[model samples]
Target: MARSYQDVLAGARERIPEIQVSELAELLESEDAPLVIDVREQDEWDEGHIPDARHVPRGFLESRIAGIADELDAPIVINCAGGARSLLAGVSLDEMGFRNVKSLAGGFSRWKQDGHDYTVPSTLTPDQRARYSRHVRIPEVGEEGQLKLLDSKVLLIGAGGLGSPSAYYLAAAGVGTIGLVDDDVVDASNLQRQIIHSNDRVGALKAESARQTIEGLNPDVSVKVHPFRVDQTNVLELMNEYDLVVDGADNFPTRYLLNDAALMTRTPLVHASILRFEGHASVFHPYEGPCYRCLFPEPPPPDMAPACGEAGVLGVLCGVMGSIQANEAIKMLLGMGDTLAGRLLIYDALSMSFNELRIRRDPECPACSDGAKLEFRDYEAWCAGERGHAEAPVSA
Candidate 1:
């Protein structure tokens, strides 16, 4: 004789022990809260689910559960759309030798009906709270701003001098996602200023070197490595993924490429450069102020401006310049304080003084001006002196 669907569910219910929604709500407030796993699909989870619930859909539960939490004896609670699926999940986990697993009674439906709140997890650990205590104590960057830092994605264009200190502080501040682009490897000569890369990382790709240092500083950060140099072809697409762009590139070619890409994408760009004792920092917001081009209009003659390697930079100057860039980036993400938009901040370490210059947007600017079309250019060739002018053709 064939069994009815209700009979199968009845059998599952007997094998699965459950905890009431009310009881679980109370348990969540305790120190020994069980790991809550949502077994719903992506769409359902996105709609609304319990706060801090680790999502592992039923289909992939068995394969991923151990990776999510290894202690079979640790208390675990599984939930779904309603009570039925959760019961089935409990039975499966029970058979898998999990010692303390329970289904959510009445599931999400009853929990919602009871006026329990639903939220995505903030994912902050107690250690993080203590680690970022200084930032939390600040009136401007209190707990809320700290949370924003943990949610922001910042793209850094290089891992050289400027990128080195900038990436370190940004990671320390708990910027959740940091994307790094650098094709060069860590060279022994870089030790003087590229503080993020150590002697052990010599010959390793700069992006990976930076990753190791940042991961060591704060495990909460996620570092995405682009192990290749930025060019016109992929610059725009790369900038699109980040909330903002930080130009730490050492050369004019990359600087121009990043500037155009940021303007075209309408993304905020924190621009900074360091040379010897003098360093410059500014924010180029596409519409709010002048883009990088509005100030220089074109790269200075190659003879006039040489790479830091050739010209020699004061090692500590990178720290000052990069820290300022990080400060500007944090301000932009938190939307606090007046930014460097339409103004340039120049720092001279020799004199230990700072100067500000006012810049205005050029209505006929090729990058951000109205009706100005963005185009891809051979930046390497342009920077290599193959082209006398800085402008590139417009893309169709």
Candidate 2:
């Protein structure tokens, strides 16, 4: 099969990527940033480097990139004691066709002489002042975002692996309210990844047990237990009251149902799922952002993926994925930072790697496209061919 443009580029960059410092700094200052990469080795970085710059030595760059969270394909500025190595790095990256990259002028020496700010261990410290203390320092996530995360409400549509860590982080982040919708009872099998609920909570209402666990983590958080399975009947009502919705469902029916309902209400849906060692996550909204239907256009079959109940998942992978989902919610609520609106984040937990794909709004999408009717329609029956699946082929 012929590779699409994205697949070809994804293949090329998967092998090699480039860097640009000045452009990196500007990007950090732009809507895309907060990134300043230090390509020097540990000892070289110790001499001097930009504050908060991620240090990934040139020698280890190829081998170590897979472990860096949210680091894939982002613009990076390389620096060394001098600009020599960074120039080579930049050129190499450019050869690999990395878009929007450059090298810092004069490396650390110039940044220091110019008084641009350098720190030790490349670690951001709290005493550095709240404004520049890591998250707040980025234009993307400012004080406004920190506060939004504190007061935001999010509902997780499941209580198994995905919901486990999604709920945990939401509570820990001080989210004002977290609604758990699940009709299943906790079971010993869940303890492997559903860390919030313990062995004792088994046989208990999964929703209620999830709530109790959140209360234990931070009593300030208000957790509402909705012991009913969310479907077309009440998904809108349950999700309407929350600021954000995290779809951790394991089946296509509920996922499509949630997508249709969220589209009708103009609510943002953080969609995610785990199968074996792979997972995909993204934010979908019909009114303001790319709807889930835009990405899939059509839902997968009911048995496309055997339920997680049958196919096992990597326990820790759920935590990693769910934490990222919570992070997106925080970024969205505070109205700061880049939420995954037009991007799809795919992860391979076994190798600890991730890839971000461009998500374009389908101008012909039935939900949010320019000519879209934006009506509440039955997704299951639609996906089930009730109205005849191929009747209206997605108008590209």
Candidate 3:
């Protein structure tokens, strides 16, 4: 005989340990807060859930648990829209060898009904309120959303053509912290497209020059400069320090490294590349969307690709694509409209037209798949003969 939903839920509750919503609220207030996981669908989560709750929908819990939590012995609390689903999830976690797991009794509804506080963005200060008044006026980026942008951190990989425009716009938009990584010195030739650098700063370090420019544009922004090339040794740690990474690197080696590093840390990467009058931009969010490796599993043959210095690029192309990158980053920080997460936007200045193509995550992606493990490798060695094909270093 088939059992009803109630019978199934009753059986699940019998095997799982549960904590009252009121008690959980008290525990949350204490210093030792348990790791709370919300097993609701995205829509349900968006409506309202616990503050700082790790969202692992019931359907994807089994696949995502290990990535989210390494210490199986830590106190873990699971919840859903109602008490029933949470009990079921608790049972599953217990079976998965997770220790000290508890289901939240009555779930979020009960917590809300019991007068327990829910999550909301903190209030902005008077100065911040005034500074972001225009952004606040926009419905999508109201006071709350503007606060999110102010709290966001974005790291840029290069201070050349792409990074120049992107950094300027992001700083102007009030991104709280901007990290720049570039080891080259500005040259006279860079003035054509690398607008952030001035002719007087020809020998100045790219990262430092960009920092000074951004600081001048917006004193509220904090610019951190990594005055060295990003390699396997420092790439992972550097990327971890920021909330998001913008790939404005001019070469395939750095691009590939950033892609792999972003996947390993599960950080979102906003990537763009330009050559001649054509430019390409996309967002790579590991697991949730396709990664750079998913699109280009391997770099092109050394002789097949030409660098910007060799093939030449239109200065305006950088502005167009880099500005789009900034647009995506702002939208991501504000949690606003759709991003180019799973789509590639291609721009052609000659035709004066834009086109888009969808990108899909590779189940066997060498860098991002759950079963795959990728470590940092010598990108320079891999791109040995392709040095000329890399994005050209900008001259001031």
Candidate 4:
């Protein structure tokens, strides 16, 4: 039967029950709050909408509703600028076998006129939309996840080999702030693996050189250069400032110090160590998974664990490990995917092989165990065998 728009809206209203704006507002605050779906256009939604409302848009309602609402019997409330569109949307949901569906009688306009609380969403500008178009297209890391990345702050313990690739990729991915802690200056020899530095920048402070490189790559990222070594005195203060730490220190003292500080500050640590023809990577989420101390109760003897400078490392190995660290850091920030929290990843370039080892948190861990007292110790002395040691774990 041919019908006018009014006739169709009248039929929808007859089929779908409508709840008044005042009633809906009270329902939102209740324990049994319904899933609020805003069927407004993009511009309308950006201006303002009900707090905790999920935007499905009237056009995509039928197609995308299932993903947002898992169960057919779940309570749902549809809303739009006025009441007509919400009524129509409720009819569609009803036809789709949704048992509990209601329309907001006066929609967002009435809700706002009634002095109800609303939220104006933060939207990306045109430049940001185009800049992170690739990331926005991803289902797991859409606009919401990208915004989280843009608001995050990460700390890198070195501006050398591993820090170079991690910082570069993180900046390109739109990480808002990156803090580089390095007292060393760039040297010509570091160019082979430390891609963030150039031959012309030799003798420049590593943190400053890396900051310049990151700024050039992505103007959206702010780089904070800390031209000082991280020690017990300043490690906690530094860790407390960032959301997560990427451990790229090549020396045992710095690595151990970062591990302890990370635990004390309850910061997630993305750790990677590159040696000749090999690399190791893992994430240490405080109290959630095994920590660095849990993996290695004691630092290996100086003779057994040689620095890359003393033992030489493959130039490409740093890129692989550092990139992994960045990946882990992003996952942690987004709170998505299974991170390497309880696992150790070992990569061997010579054999072209990858291996994983499960890491269980030590109940008696000196740093992360239940009721364990976390305090900074003389990491340099401990690593150099000046302090008492225990049998180190066998795996990397």
Which candidate number has the best lDDT? 4
Runs of candidate 3 with Cα error greater than 4 angstroms are: 1-121, 385-396
Stretches of model 4 off by over 4 angstroms after superposition: 1-4, 7-17, 59-67, 87-101, 349-354, 388-396
RMSD of 4: 4.1
Model 1 misplacement above 4 A = 1-123, 385-396
- 246-329 in candidate 4: lDDT tens per residue? 999989989887888888789999999989999999999888899999999878879999999999999999999999999999
Tens-place lDDT digits, model 3, residues 281-374: 9999878999998988778866777889889999989999999999999988877789999999999999998999998998898778778767
Q: Could you tell me the TM-score of candidate 4?
A: 0.87
Give the deviation of candidate 2 from the true structure as CA RMSD. Answer: 14.0
For each candidate in turn, the TM-score is: 0.69, 0.62, 0.67, 0.87
- Listed per model in order, the count of residue pairs whose N, CA or C atoms clash below 3 Å is 0, 7, 5, 0
lDDT of 4 at 121: 85
Q: Which 10 consecutive residues of model 4 have the lowest summed lDDT?
A: 387-396
Model 1 steric clash pairs: none
Ranking by TM-score: 4, 1, 3, 2
Q: What ranges in model 2 sit over 4 Å off?
A: 1-146, 376-378, 381-396
How far in Å is the alpha carbon of 197 misplaced in model 2? 0.8
lDDT against true structure, model 4: 0.90
lDDT of 1 by residue, 274-337 (tens): 8889999999998889998888776776898987888899999999999999999999999999
Between candidates 1 and 3, the lDDT winner? 1
Best candidate, TM-score: 4
